[model samples]
Target: MKENRSREMYEEIKNITKTFQPRLGVIKDEKGNILTESKQIVDRWKRYCEKMYSSDSTADQQEKLEETREDKEINLLPLRSEIEWAIGSLKDGKSPGCDDI
Candidate 1:
């Protein structure tokens, strides 16, 4: 039992210490130049994300959205009977979904 445990521990340690070399395909910059250095690749990705998601609205737009929200009707929750019907409709003996239901 001790020998088996030691062998398992050795295998675990070997797996942990193994260098993980991920095969990242060639990543190119916006100018179509391939980036090789780690810093250059990271910076190119940062610039891309910034350009892609920089269109967030300003604070004034947020206030306008809040003001408009009050005009919309409030949504009601489903009745207990309706919820029970939905749950009862699911097939039996299958794995539960990510929600565990």
Candidate 2:
């Protein structure tokens, strides 16, 4: 019967998933030592994010942006009507993008 076949297929899929082991590559720290423990991995990632997104970088980035703006002549600004048309052209009810709309 169709019900029996569906049940067999579900059981086969369950067994396959139960045996599945994702192959994760090795992660290391700044000292070039392999990190195996979950806590160590989490801590390493935390440290990396903290270093990458430190508060002092914001002011430095703003200064660099101002310098770049002063050095470059920007003439590719889109008109407000063009931007509205672009937004209106997009279909609704779709999945949100990376910035979540």
Best by lDDT: 2
TM-score for all models, in order of appearance? 0.38, 0.45
State the displacement of the C-alpha of residue 64, model 1, in Å, after optimal TM-score superposition: 22
Model 2 is weakest, by summed lDDT over 10 consecutive residues, at 92-101
What candidate 1 gets wrong by more than 4 Å, as runs, is 1-21, 56-101
Q: Pick the candidate with the highest TM-score.
A: 2
Clash counts for all predictions? 0, 0
Taking the tens digit of each residue's C-alpha lDDT, what string does model 2 give over 1-101?
A: 46659888988889988865886556899999999888898899999998778888777888899999999878879999999998898889765566543
**CA error at residue 6 for candidate 1, angstroms:** 6.2
Q: Candidate 1: lDDT over CA atoms? A: 0.82
| Clash-forming residue pairs, model 2 | none
Which stretches of candidate 2 lie above 4 Å from their native place?
1-8, 14-23, 75-101
| lDDT by residue for model 1 (67-87), tens | 899877679788999999999
Q: Rate the local accuracy (lDDT) of all candidates.
A: 0.82, 0.85
